[model samples]
Target: MRMTTNANRRVTDEQIERARSIDLVQFLQQYEPPGELKRIGQSWTLKSHDSMRISADGRWNWFSQNKGGGDAIGFLQAVHGMSFQDAVRTLAGEDFKTIPTTQAEHKAKPPERAAFALPPKNNGNRRVFAYLHRSRGIAAEIINHCIKNDLLYEDAQHHNAVFVGKDENHNARYAFLRGTLTASHFRQEATGSDKSYGFFLRGSGKTLFVCEAAIDALSIATLRKFDGLDWKKDNYLALGGVTASESKLPAALERTLNTFSFKRVVLCFDNDAAGQTAARRIFTMLRQQFSENLEVQTCVPKVKDFNDQLCVKLQNGKNSPSRGTRESTLSR
Candidate 1:
C-alpha cells in the first residue's frame, strides 16, 4: 500500500481509517466548549447549529447544509472547513490517543452542561411589543397572548424579544433572543438551551404547523387572525431553523411529533431555496417515518416568509393578494 507523508512522518491507510473512524460526538464533546453539543433522544446535535446531528454509531449529518460524514475527520472537514490532510493529521496525533474499536469504547464522559435560564425580564415589554407589532407586523392580540402565556417577553438589559420553549412538564427549557433595535439583526439561542423544545404555541386542533423562526410562527398566527379565523386553533412550532437532508428531521419537530398526537403536519418555511428544499425533504421524511399515520404538507408564503406576507397585507390593505393566492399548500 502507498504511504502518504504529513510533516516528516509517513501516514498509512490504516492510520487514516483509524482517524476517520474516531467517534464524532466524542470528538466534539472533548474539544468543543461545554454545552456546545447537546443530546436529543438518541442523537447529539450542535448547540449553535441545531440542524446538525451525530448518531451514536459514529455517523454525522448536517441536514441544513446538506453535508455529512461517517466520522470525526469528516466532521472536521465539513464543519470547520478543514482540509482532509489537516483533519487526519489532527486526529491521528499522539496527544489524542485513539480509543478501542468498540461501540462501548466510543462513549466518553460528556462535560457538565451549563444551567439553563431565561434572560432577566424587562420591567416592561414596550420595545418587544413595538418591534413585533410595528416592525414585524405581528398583531397586538397575538403579542399579548404570547406574553400572557409566558411564551414571550422582553430582556431587561438589551430589550431583546425572548421567546421561550417548554418541555412536556411545561418547564421552560429553551429560549431564543432577537434584538428589538431596527439597526441590529442579532439573534441567538440562550445558553444551555435545548433545541428539541422549541418556542411553540399549543392548540386544540390536530394540525401542527412548523416554521423556521418564532417571529414567522407569530406572523402565521396573525395572518390567521386576519382571515377571520381563531389564531390559536392549530399548533404552531418554530424549528429555530430547518435542515435540507431528507433522511434527518429537526430535533424540535421530532420531539413535537412524539409528544403530541397530530394527524397533520404543515411545513411553513421561508420561500427561499434552502427553506423550500428543507420543506420538501422534511415532507418526505415524515412520510417515511409515520407512513399513513400522518399527513404531510407544505404551506409556503407568496413572499419571503409569513412576516413579509403580513407586512405586505398591512401595506396594501384590500389590494393585497387574497389569502388563497398569498399562500399555497401542497398535500402529500
Candidate 2:
C-alpha cells in the first residue's frame, strides 16, 4: 500500500498517534550517522553546527540558536526542514528514502572543532599546589612539573585546580576543574571541554596507569617516585571518573590507544563499587577489543583511591623522612 499525502491532506488521528509513539532516540540511532548523536546524562545532544539537545521526554532546544523543541514531528520540521505531512510520514515508516540524504547532509559538514577554554588563572597556583602537595599528599615536584608544562593550574576566580588535557597539536582541548577547599566537592568541566583529550602525564614506560581523577593520577605518580622508580617514565591518565554506561570505552582511553603504543593497560580506579565496576567493564572491553598481546590488568587502590592511600601512607610514617609530616618536602 502506497502512502501518499499532500500538504492540504489532513493526517488521520491514527497516523499522528503512530508517529508520536515512535521512539525518537531509537529512530535517530537507526537513521543518523555515527558521532552525530551523543547521550549526555538523560538527554541526547545532536552534534550540529549549532548544538541542539533533546531530552528523554521528546523536548529539545538548540543552545547556540534561537530555537525550542517540540514533538518528533517538530524535530524533523525544525532540523530537517520537513513539512508537517512529510515529518509524520517519515516517523510512521512510510517515507524512508530521504534518510540517506539527511545523513549525507550531516556528514558533508565540517567536523566540530574543540572550542576549549580554560578558566581564569591566578598569579600562581599557590592554593592548588598546597592542596595537592599538602592535603592530597602529591609530591610538590610532580605538581610543579605539571604546572610548568601547562598541564595544570589554579583558577583565579575560585581557586580551583584546573587540570588541562591537550591535543596532539599541544592545544588545550579539555579542562577538569576541582575546588581547592578541603571541604568542598565542587568540580566541573570547563565549557566546551572535550573528553577525548584527557589530562595525562606522559611517560616513556609501556605500562599505562589509569585513575579516576587528576589527583589520583598525581598520587600514583607520587607513589611511584617514593618507590625509587622514574615516575616520569610511566604514563598516567585520569579518566575524569569512570562511566557506568555500557558503551564503548571513554574517549580518553580510546584516543590514547589510537595515538600511543602501549603493551600494558592498568586499571587503577578507586576501590569502590562504581570504580570497581568501571574497571571490570574496561578490562573486559579492552580484552575483547585488543588481541592477547595487550595486557589488561586491574590495580585497585589499597584504600578508597590513590590519593587517600597516599595520605594514609604518609601519616603512618611510611616512605617519609620524618613521621607525621603532612607537607611535601620534595624539591620543587
Candidate 3:
C-alpha cells in the first residue's frame, strides 16, 4: 500500500482504509455519551441530534444538515470538525482497530446513569407565581394550570421555578430550573434528567407546537388565550435549547411524536439564527419522515422569542397583534 504524510504524520493507505471502515455507532458509543445514542426502528439516532442516523451497515447520515458519509472517518470529520489526519489517527488507535461490526458483537455495557429525583418543594409557590406572571408575562391561569397538574413548582433550597417532565406513566423523568431572582439569569437541568421527557402540555387538538424554553411554551399558551383561542385545545412542547449548528431532532420532540398523534407540527422556535436553523432542520426531517400525513411548518415570532412577544403584547394592550398576526409561517 502507498504512504502519505498528513500534517507531519506518515500514514499508510491500508491504515487509512482501516480507519474509514471502523463502525461509526461503536465509535460514538465508545467516545460519546452512550445514553444519547438511541435505536429508532432499524437505524440508530443520537439524542443530541436526532436527525442524524447510523445504519446497521456502518453508514451515517445527518438528514437535517444535508450531510452524510459512508464510515467513521467521515463522521468525525463532518460532525466533530476533525481534519482527515486527526480522524485517521484517532480511529487507527489500538482500541478502535478491533471495533465490532454489529451491536451484538459489542459487549461493553454503558456506565450506570444516576437516579433522577425532583428537588424538594418549597412551602408555597408564591415566588414562582410572582416571578412567572410579573417577569415572564405568563398568565396566572396558565401558571396555575401547570401547578395544578404538578408540572411546575418552587424548589425549597433555591426557590427556583422547577419545570417537570414526566413519562407515560406520569413518573417524573426530567426537571428544568430557572432562577426567580430579578438579577439572576440562572437556568439548568437537574442532574440525571432525560431530555426526551421535556416539559410539555398535551391538548386534544391535532397540532403540536414546539419551543426552545419552558417560558416560551407558556408564553405561546398565554398568547393563544389572549387571542380568544382555547389554549388547552392545542399541544405545546419545549426543547430546552437549540444551537445554530445542531441538526438533531431533539430527544424531547422525538418522544412527543411517538406518544401523540399530532397531524400538524408547528415549529415555534425563536426568530434568531439558531432558532431559524433548528426550525428549518426539524421541519425538513418531519416532512420527510411523516410524508403527507403530517403537516410540518414554522411559525416564528416577530421578535426573538414568544416570551418577548408576550411581554410586548402586555405592554401595548389588546390592540397589539395576536399570536399568528405578527408571526411569519414557513411551509416549504
Candidate whose TM-score is highest: 1
What residue runs in model 3 are displaced by over 4 Å at the alpha carbon? 1-111, 243-247, 319-332
lDDT to native, each model: 0.77, 0.73, 0.75
Please give the ranking of all candidate structures by TM-score, highest first, separated by commas: 1, 3, 2
Residue-wise lDDT of candidate 1 within 82-156, one digit each (tens)?
657767876775435554555435455443456888999999999999999888889898999999999999999
Encode model 3's per-residue lDDT on 1-332: one tens digit a residue. Answer: 11223545666798797786566667776667658777654456788876675655555656455455556766776677766777787788633345555653463243344677899999999999999999989989999999999999999999999999999999999888889997776766776677789999878888888988899999988888776677888888987665332344677898999988988888888776556866877788787778978988788787778898888878777523343343343211
How do all models score by TM-score?
0.69, 0.65, 0.66
Clash pairs (backbone) in predicted model 1: 63-244
Q: For model 3, what is the error of residue 299's alpha carbon versus the real structure, in angstroms, after optimal superposition?
A: 1.2
User: Per-residue CA lDDT of candidate 2, range 198-282, in tens?
Assistant: 9989998788888777888898788777766678988988876565333468679999989999888888887765577668878
Top candidate on lDDT is 1
Cα lDDT of model 2 overall? 0.73
Higher-lDDT candidate among 2 and 3?
A: 3
